[model samples]
Target chain A: MYKGYVVDKALLDKDPHFKAGCILCHAGNDGELSKEKAHLRMLKKPSDNLRSCGVCHKKTAANYAKSLHYTTIGQRTGVMPRFSEAELKTFDEKVFEKSCRSCHASCGDCHVKGAPVGGISIGLVAKHKFVKKDEGKTCAFCHGGRVYPEYTGDYGGAPDVHYQKGMLCMDCHKKAEFHGDGTAYKSKNEVPQRPACKSCHPQGKEAKKETQVAHSLHDGKVSCYGCHSGSAYRNCNDCHGGHAAAGPGMILGRSPRDRKVLTTLRLIPTVRDTFAPAGIKMEHFDAVPNYWDTPAHNIKKRTERTRKCDVCHVDRKNFLTKETLIKNGAKANEELIFVPKAIAR
Target chain B: MKNRRTFLLAFLAVWILALYGAAVFAATPNKCIQCHTNDALMKSLHKPPVLPKSEGEG
Candidate 1:
């Protein structure tokens, strides 16, 4: 590192203390650079490595714990019962050489200032040429056909390029915003200054004012989840719900037709059901101490918690604006919102 | 009868040890104060560092 061999001379002068060497992220110092010693570094468990980096990103690691990645491992007591360790070890030997570069892709490779053969150039970044077949390759490794399914009869799935070619998970999965143990609190407004939805749909305000364009426009009311994630929309269901949000939104026995009336599924405190309401059924909108004990965060009871609406009377301030409202046609006032931060990010 | 009672006690001890091992092993909460007491965790999880009220809202 002191020799400052391939590192840019100008860049090094600017940031003198920059630890620019393999030893920073990897192990084995003596400059031997043996393949066996490099692989020995893998013996250090992921959790231990996480502790080293957790100091820099305290909040992000906590949220990652609650996410699907950690949750899957946690549920099985850190064991994949279906696949034996021996079988996986054998499979690793057969297919690993061809697949390792793609499936277990790391951030170090992508974010490195300048790499060789696959350096951080605009062309390489644009095409995501780092991993030959990136998304399908990584997701399918652990997640079966349901995810990046190469099988037939998996009809209602998005085309692979959406996850593969498009802005992949790394683009949006905010670092230092998740916990290692895997529990993401809803309080984290990704863009507290702005919002998440408006990032992709900047002209959403104009869209909300029109009947045809606005997804929120239902019979006469707005499906807030279609806009701000209310009702059936809960947690991180907005983007990941490629299929109909079948997790929390699965109403006990209600059929399709009954959905409209039973739409407001209040999380009324209940005995731990055999299936749903696995743990404590705390209200969605947790109390902001000293403010009020109003039950917020529930699908059916959000607007009442967040905003005062002209549900019965005409909001004279918004007649010209609220004209687009399908249900509250009488309401003269209305406002629209989206995840506004994506624009700035 | 004496032998059966001794066996039962040994089994109970093993069972209790296993349960405690699982619970404590799963939730390993370490304190950063070991090396650096001043960290963001202290701010987020620790009691607020504000002066106690004296008289009232003066």
Candidate 2:
């Protein structure tokens, strides 16, 4: 009698979840013939509690529990470095769980329901149907602020050539990567199922030798994005929670994560003193610079920078300079400023 | 007899027109049904062909 609990006849007969009836995952008063009685205690997103999914997908549940999506460790690492020892303790014990960890995804978030992003939770993804993959709804919903938009040309610039060929996210990102092959990887880098440009376009086969020779000139100093990221990309400087204004442009910076001396740049939000509530005083607020080794997804076969070597070799203005840093209000970003000049390199 | 024949012919014409109209309406499938019961869309997207059981029996 519950309007939301419309049973599919084929699903009821064929599927095991329905074979046990809706009560197994969604605990409600299904026995009562009356609509009011049957609707009592109905669970909308059963995977949120994890009791239902864990009963079936124990291994995957255990793995996903430790995933970056679940832990949000990157954000913690970025923010916690600036906190004093005492401040870190307070953040870890009290604030981290509620403030930071609330951004994490439960099992239901991707598969069955919308995730909380930009401070809003969306409705059921497929009207309570369990979808295996819905890139537009699931992945884009979470990563929409950056990667997903760039991939589809929604942010600006031409879409990733891959998407033009009708290649969806799952085409490259296989099931094992999403399902967490029982690995509790800290970052995306450690995931064995993680994809690289070389995985699909090997150096000799798809990437011609001429490209390799040109790549060698950089001496592994610059990221592929340094040359190949076409047009400008959306970047935000002073992101205070969900409210950050973005502009389309490019910057070059050294990475803290991999120590890549030259890399395609992005603005660092959550810098020192960000998201610290009214009363909580931070002693070493500016202790760490949060400039990350970013994989800017605004990719193309050739970019304005890559078209001519002299564009980067001769051009000092395009590189992230003291003036540019001051203009972007990122002069305080000491980690990014110390990179060797493009001309000298 | 002539009047009777004319009445029967009119009734037959109305019946044919009604059948044709019903057929035309039925040709355009319901939007909700088109998505909810669309097997091809589900299969192409690699959404589960059948929902799995609680016991891992899909």
Residue by residue across A169-226, what tens digits does model 1's lDDT show?
A: 4444444332333443323322232223346544445433443353343322422322
Q: Candidate 2: where are CA atoms >4 Å away?
A: A1-10, A32-36, A118-122, A181-183, A206-209, A241-243, A326-332, A338-345, B1-58
Provide the interface RMSD of candidate 2 in angstroms, 1 decimal place.
16.4
lDDT per residue as tens, model 2, A1-345: 121223244554555655555667767665564444655886756787655788988888877777777777756766665667877888877777866677777888878777756444455566566778778878887778777888899887788888888988888888777767665676677778877776876554645777777776765688777777776776765565445456877777776665556777677665434545533455555454445666777778887776676676676435766666633232345667544445644
**lDDT (CA) for every model shown?**
0.29, 0.65
In order, what DockQ does each candidate have?
0.01, 0.01
Clashing residue pairs, backbone N/CA/C < 3 A, model 2: A16-B53, A17-B53
Model 1 misplacement above 4 A: A1-48, A55-144, A147-167, A170-345, B1-58
DockQ of candidate 2 compared with the true complex: 0.01
